[model samples]
Target: MSVWPAYAEIRFADYGEDFDPSVERTEMERGVPKQRLLNTDVLQTIEASVQFRSAQAVEDFERWYFIDVKRIGWFSMEHPRTGEPINARFRNGRIGRLQPLNTLFRFAKRDLVIEYVRAPQ
Candidate 1:
């Protein structure tokens, strides 16, 4: 058996990208007021939403996320806007849910917060 858990393949069409780039700042006493030091790399946080029309779809995704993906801790994900692949994991401890108002439809929506993981040098 493979060591990796079997997770459902889910693609996100659109997502919000947050890229934060910063530099280390230090306060100087005598000459300079502030000193800007080391440059920090970009930190990425992606926010996405997925809608499941049926109960089966919801169950499948939930199992894949909470059981398989969550168990693995980290996985590769493709950025929706740039299409660049990055190592990412769930940002929040809990998943947001939105249930359809109509009982007949039984649709479910989930909002996901994914944070990119930096590689070690």
Candidate 2:
């Protein structure tokens, strides 16, 4: 599997953290609603933005994104919360375009909604 580019600085923003549960709720006749899990193997999603500082870092990220993940469409990176390695794909199978952090173009950032492909070890 393709690994996240080390050059990409994961300056995560203060957004929602933790995996969202995939559940199916059932309406009961006389009792509380029952919830059933839809996924047992795949875990929660990791959504965050990564920052790229420096010209070379941006170039490296472009290559990795277009070449490595273009076809396979998935990559492995450290879980933002757990710090353990996990397999994940672009959130909704797509990544948003990068934006310059400032006018100078010395920094860049992109939003990523990464869905876990499997349970983390």
Candidate 3:
């Protein structure tokens, strides 16, 4: 039987610093800091998602997800020919990749809903 790989749905949101940076940009027509949000506001916009990763991925995202792995998901195959268990069979295996953190962050008004579900270790 195939094992239900361990996974996690981490949800994080941040509109940068507590206060908008002094260099707050603006729209072409408005000619001012059009609109922005506080850190808490962003914390509430990011949608929840799941990512299947080895134990290593947990620490990686926890520390560098913002830059390395923006979004989160189960990629079909990370290492296809390393003599390892490849996950290329969409019919039975899994795939991993970044989710929709980009679009989610772009939205100034959205609800944050991250769902983390990992198989018991």
> Best lDDT goes to which candidate?
2
Q: Report the lDDT tens digits of candidate 2 across residue range 1-121.
A: 8998887766656334556566789999999999988876645666677888876787788788788888348788887776888777776556667789887668988776777755534
Worst 10 residues of 3 by lDDT: 86-95
**lDDT of each residue in 23-107, candidate 3, tens digit only:** 4345776455465532322211113234424444444444443333323432332221133332221212122344443433321
lDDT of 1: 0.58
* Per-residue alpha-carbon lDDT of candidate 1 for residues 1-121, written as tens digits (9 for 90 to 100): 1121223223366457675555565677667666463444555677776566666766776676676676436766555566667677777655566555357536666676767744333
After the best TM-score superposition of candidate 3, give how far the Cα of residue 84 lies from its true spot, in angstroms: 34
Residue 104 in candidate 2 has what lDDT?
64
Total backbone clashes of model 2? 1
TM-score of 3: 0.19
Question: lDDT scores for all predictions?
Answer: 0.58, 0.73, 0.31
Best by TM-score: 2
Q: What TM-scores do the predictions have?
A: 0.63, 0.79, 0.19
Q: Quantify how close model 1 is to the true structure by its C-alpha RMSD in Å.
A: 4.9
- Error (Å) of candidate 3 at residue 102 is 28
